[model samples]
Target: MFATRSEAGDRLAAELEGRGVEADVVLGIPRGALPVARPVADALEADLDVVVARKLGAPNNPELALGAVASDGSVWYNDALIDRLDVSDDYLEEIRAEEAQNAREKADRYRDSPGLPDLEGERVLVVDDGVATGATATACLRQVRAADADYVGLAVPVGSPQSVADLEAEADEVIALETPENFRAVGQFYREFGQVTDEEAIAYLEGLGGRS
Candidate 1:
């Protein structure tokens, strides 16, 4: 198991460098992704920024992600799960609007300007501690694409094999240190998984949030 998010980030940076992966900017999904994205930005010599997406919880199960929606309205829905749950379209619409606002507020807290930077014609990488359902990542990638980034990708320390495979459709490239068959959750691969505070997460932005 990876020792910590920082260690995982370091290892992830190494893997990217070995494969000649490069980025003009690196964005970490706030709260948990900041620690991991810090090392990656330092290693890549890329500007550090934040991307925000909030998971739409399943009915009566807030922990379960039905999908995720980004601050800019970019979203991804787990059709299979929604169908299985028989979630109504009205509920989905309401929840998506609620979560989108939450994501925007989060991005605002971390960034002075809030939202994405000017990524048009630039290569961008989205870093996360790990992936479970990939709902958030998909939304984040869509947001990046909407910004007209020349290339958009995702990198993680570990992820569920199925989720990693599924994300291939969202990003130009998907990189993960591990995609174990036995993957139960993102925390299982991290030896030092802990919640990152908003204050702590903002520090990683390095005042490089976004440029006008």
Candidate 2:
């Protein structure tokens, strides 16, 4: 098992070598994804950037993510989750507006201009630590796709097999170190999994040569 995010990224980068993926850049979905993408960007010898997305939490139970919204208003929702939770369209719009604002704020804090990156003809490696329900990652993938990237690859150290399968339809390529069938949560595999603050995550990206 990898000792830390950097080590996990190093191993992941080695795995991504020469899959016809001429990496023009690496973008991490903060706050946890930034550290994981740093070493990969270094290994790929490409520019590093940051992508921010926020979970659109349920109105009553804010801990549960009904969907996610990226900085640019890109959203990916779990229809099943919303149905199960009985979330209404009006409530969803309210939550989406609040969460989208938070996402934009974080994006602003991380970059000079939090607007989507220029990916017209570039191949980007999007890194995240892991995926649980994949709602957030799916939203992120949509935002990246909207940028018109020449090629997009989704890379994570660990994710549920089903989550990986779900994301494959959204990305050109999907890479993961482990896809355990019984995966319950991403934190179950990490020993040092902790909350990453916006400031610290931005600092990590800045150290990796990240720019808006």
Candidate 3:
């Protein structure tokens, strides 16, 4: 288990180097992932940025995700789960719209502007602290694709085997340090999975400008 997010980021960055992965930019899914992504950007010598996506929680169990929407309105829906849960289209649309706007506002706040980085023809690496359901990661991947990134990759310190397998289809390459067979939750793998405040997350992004 990683002692801290920074340690996980360092290991993930080392893994990417061993795999010969190179990126023009690294986009971290805030606010937990920013700490992890900072070390990755430093290691790869790439520009760091935020890729905002918010999970659309279930009506009854808000902790459970129905889907997710990115800042650019790119969405990833769990159709089977939604159908099984008998969620209505109207309800889904309502949550999707709300979450999309939330994601947009978050992206704007992190960037300090509405403008996103130019990713056309550039290799993009999308980093997250870890993947559980992978709903948000899917949305973020779609958003990166929408930006016309020449290559889109995913990097995480650890993940469930199923989630890692599923993400292989979405990203050009996926670098997961560990995929435990009996994974319960993302936090289970980390010794110190503390919450990252918005100010702390923003500072990581702001520091990237000096590197570029």
The TM-score values for the models, in the order shown, are 0.95, 0.92, 0.96
Alpha carbon lDDT of each predicted model: 0.90, 0.83, 0.91
Candidate with maximal TM-score: 3
Instruction: Write one digit per residue (lDDT tens) for candidate 3, span 124-143.
Output: 99999999999999999999
Name the candidate, 1 or 3, with the larger lDDT value. 3
Candidate ordering by TM-score (highest first): 3, 1, 2
Winner on TM-score between 2 and 3 is 3
What is candidate 1's lDDT per residue for 78-108, written digit by digit as tens?
Answer: 8999999999999999999999999998888
Listed per model in order, the count of residue pairs whose N, CA or C atoms clash below 3 Å is: 0, 0, 0
lDDT tens digits, residue span 1-212, model 2: 45666667777778877554558889899888877888788778878888778898887788788989988899988899899888899999988888889888878887787587798888988899888888888888888889999888899999999989999999999999999888998878777777777776767777732321
RMSD values for the candidates in order, in angstroms, are 3.6, 2.9, 2.5
What TM-score number comes out for model 2? 0.92
